[model samples]
Target: MNSPDIKPPGAEPAVKTHDNRRRWWTLLAVSAAQLLVVLDGTIVNIALPSAQTALGMSDASRQWAITAYALALGGLLLIGGRVSSALGHRRTFIIGLVGFAASSALGGAAVNPGMLFGARALQGVFAAALAPAGLSLLTTTFTEPRERGRAFSVFAAVGAAGSALGLVAGGLLTEYTSWRWCLYINVPIALFAVGGTALVPADRPIRGGGRLDVAGALLSAAGFGAVVYAFNEAEPLGWGSPKVLALLVGGVLLLAAFAAVEVRAPSPLLPMRVLSHRARAGALVSITLMFVAMFGFYLFMSYYTQTVLGYSPVQAGLTLIINALAALLGSTLIAGRLHGRVPPAMLILPGLIAAAAGMLILTRLTPQTTDVLPLYLVPALVLTGLGLGCVLPPTAGLATSDVHPYDIGAASAAYNASQQLGAALGTALLNTIATSAAASHLASARHATPTGASVHGYTTALTVGFGILLAAACVTAPLILKQQRS
Candidate 1:
């Protein structure tokens, strides 16, 4: 008879096969959750007009629907991450899914602006919890280096394509069906993920998980909330506005205080150890800067296609699908295949340069360039997508790699927060730049048509985006070098 500790002849392979299959299934569930989070950004953006019209929302009030989500998600991300560590990642993830589904249903049935805004805020609250938990799950599940690369690549591709896919989905749903379906759509997704949860391995939660630092949580939430609100206000109030400036400064101060609190607090929400690594810091910086440019890229592209090229909403949305598809290619064929063989800088440097080049090309768009799809948007989108593909997988790995098992959620949350802030700042900053440029062009060129002025403004902002991307590469280089040297 076999010893008590010994397995039967075929047991090991069978167990290995079972484990392998479970890992991929976990990835699928995680990816679906990620897509659900990301797609909401642009999907609701598309549905906003219809939502406003249906609910009889005023212009000023309409902005609140979007701002509520941004503020809640951005502010609560760190707290959410800590909660996951304390409660258990798997449990937090399912709770988030259930809450998100409930909120989506609430939004779908809303008959007033206040109700809609509250539901969207609820969605953001749950998403903040869900996003970090899912990421931690991925990191803990895939430990082998090469397989991690593959898993990250697949995950990054889904994230990279998510916004563009949102645009497409929003357009189709809003056009062909009711805007309510846009909110309704998430229910089925959440349910499917709930089912997929059965296959996910019950990973261990952080040790002594209940010792959360209350002060640190409060500080982080307020600081991040202030900063996000400041940026959101900047789009409407301008950077020089006293209210915006005050909020921005206050946010910075609160964040600094939070850092000090973390130094002394026994169970800090965001531990210093999570960011002590040079490579991880670099990764976070790179992703943040890329998003600062990328969101503006999407903003300008959508307007240029619709307002300038005269494409329908669906047509404008369709143009972005190419970018998503190209990102998929870049993630799978390039980064996934090459991650282990190369230093991250090898992929990262070239990716930034390529994306910058794409931004540069977009700076030359003319009102009459509508027919230049082959020579213009196609190449730009392809390059940007490929570059994003290269950057995301590598940076994602670096951001959370080699951290203490318990801090994984904190690290992942930090990365997500970087992305959220970057997007908020990008939209505000580039939009301000474009709006000012348009006013300047209109003043200088009496012959400029309104449409021409708008396009000119967009191109000018694209140039700023191009410069920002180059700056990002410069920032990455020395950080990577220092990490390498150490």
Candidate 2:
């Protein structure tokens, strides 16, 4: 007689065959939505100068274009997650796509900076719903370990390379057409993603005992909003300014209150149990730290290629293709192939090491450096890309893996929150460091040329970023050890 634990051969084959047929379609749908959101985060960087010129906005106001999106997306993610669980993943995902498309169209038709900013913020609101719902769907849909690995490999690769791809697409559009096309382009992409959603499995919405935690949601949103505002203020007002100081303190206090509320709430917006797993917590933290370096790379590279190397926006965007290709290969081949064969840290640790080494290579830049591309920048970027590609897929998988079904949406949103906040913090902190370094060089030196000071500033800021990447590696190392011991 067959063992009680064994499934009938026919039964297993039927289930497996169905998943094989339907899984690829689901992946395509989710991936398209993800690309829409991730690409938007950096697409504007390339178009910012043109957008500012078109809208007659000052340098001081340019950051609002990015910050507004980050603030709304990051702050409201918890509510988005909870709402997705209450309504249903498939329904919320489609709604988000539609909303995002409408906002993109609005932004494309903007007559002023205020219009553009408002549109971008609305785009973030929809994305807050779309991103987590897509991730949670992937988490629940792929039950088999191997299939899950492959799904996440594609998802993470697209996510890792989306920002680089944005630079390329943004440049081509801005140089050849108009900056408005960058926003308009998302309409087609989102509409296409929405069309594909019919193939995804019909997921049941959470019901009964899943009441919204109104107080917890409010506290978290307000707290995160304040923190995001403080970081934006720090770019121009200095870190120690009273406005920045008050916001920082208030944000922290509110967040502390949020934690207290979560622990007591009957239906917590972020159920404490979702964060109880050590591996999941570690994965979330690692994702946050990695993006700190990754976003800084994107921000600095755009300026460096344009201002220092005298490359046009199109040329600068093309240069990033090398990095994107490396990342794509590493995610599919290295991380994808090793998914079930080895421990995740086995991939993540080496990836972090390679990324940190790449940053060290970048620290060699100077005003006298003429061949930045052929020699230093290309190889360094490739290394960073490979490392990130290897690291991101596995960590993302871990963040939502093995969670209770109802909590998956919240788990996915928390991961996204970590990434968005990391990007905001990295952009603000690194920009501040670069600007301060340049000013100090001018003040202290007897004969400081603008080129010398600028290059010095870029390198100094990157050096700090390098150290942060190393710190990230250190953070992951202990978690790996703990998992091994257990």
Candidate 3:
């Protein structure tokens, strides 16, 4: 005789409701973590000069403050993604938030340069963990089509605005408080976010008890690290240096090995299945290209505002409000409307073209240029923002679209990894191009007038920025548009 059929009460249904509520809270917590991490990259830029004078850093060592974070974050992002999948998003997210906050505190309190740099690198490692986990949490939390689109729009907008907000926040904090506050600010934010994380649901691990692809992780990390190092070296060591050549070759070989290993591994770190769809591939490429152009624009435009136009950090930061506001509008309004109305590929093509046009307009800046009113620079800034806004949301949505639910973490990780690498490469390559152009311009002008040559050099750099933007547009056009008909 069967024991009375066990009803188990209504506990199962209750548990599911509780879990759903927790998942929504988790998305908020994760998004907060992501915003902090992304903002740190640019916030430091505004405070760099102040930090430099206070810390007595040399010109060459200055870039390391930024590069240290990028190198570690970009290099380890894929590993972080895979690790999150293997462990659990909830666990990884918590660990990352705690680690990131601790590092930020350390960096803020540093009395010496070495400590600060080390802290930044540590922050990068945790950021690598936090970013993908945050994204994957969103991907899993919102499974319905409309809810997914809304969720991604909010995520994308936060990400797009993060850099601009960093500039403004950095200026205020640096001027009123200290450069260290920029780092210290993360502590409280992270703490609050961590508390919120407790409310989010934890996802179960992929079946087969996911294994770490040690070889794949190493190969991918080392390869990206090598390539980034090569780009950084190119500016000081020359493009043809033996060390540069060695690094390029080593990076290529390691990446080739990573591809091979991914093909063979039963539980791959980044599976090929995530990239099988044409729309997804197009979206990833478009996102990469958008960052490529936008990062370079930021690098040059910041310099143009401060060094060339003689604006203080606060003034320059304020000017960027135009771009920031435009981006916010584009992400929220334009991006939301275009979601199902037009395919992502079509949206990306025009978005990139507009960004390229903005870059071209900026190339006209000169030493005597004082106002953005007559020169079309304000509109250019707005266009840049609009283009970025259009590209980021849809591209982000498409990148993780069509993947199996179990693979969301890995897919999100891959998307974030590509973005980080793209930004780093874009920064390094564009800086090198601008620096070389500046040197050439200065060399020619030195014979004519020594004092004026510095300004001439800056103009030359901005010109090169224009060319890079154009090239980015050309590269992305085919990739984005070719998939439209298919």
Highest TM-score: give the candidate number: 1
* lDDT for residue 249 in candidate 3, whole number 0-100: 95
Candidate numbers, best lDDT first, in rank order: 1, 2, 3
**Model 3: pairs clashing at backbone N, Cα or C within 3 Å:** none
Clashes of each: 0, 0, 0
For model 3, the stretches where C-alpha displacement exceeds 4 angstroms are: 1-27, 52-62, 235-238, 368-370, 445-486
Task: Estimate the lDDT of model 3.
Answer: 0.78
Q: Whose TM-score is higher: candidate 2's or candidate 3's? A: 2
- Model 2: lDDT of residue 346: 86
Q: Candidate 1, which segments miss by more than 4 Å at Cα?
A: 368-370
Could you estimate the TM-score for every candidate? 0.98, 0.94, 0.88
Residue 250, model 2, lDDT: 96
Better of 1 and 2 by TM-score: 1
- Candidate 2 error regions (>4 Å): 1-15, 58-62
C-alpha RMSD (angstroms) for model 1: 1.3
lDDT of each residue in 1-486, candidate 3, tens digit only: 656765588978998888768866866797688789779989988888888888888888987777788778878988888777767788888899999999999989888788888999999999998888888888778777666666676677778878878988899999999999999999999999999987887677666635778898888889988887776776677777899889889989998899999989877878888876666776777677677667777776676677656778877787777888888778778876667777776666677777777877766665555665447568878988888877787888877877886677778887887777677666666766676666676677545443245445545555665555566556766655676665
List per-prediction Cα lDDT, in the order shown: 0.91, 0.87, 0.78
Best by lDDT: 1
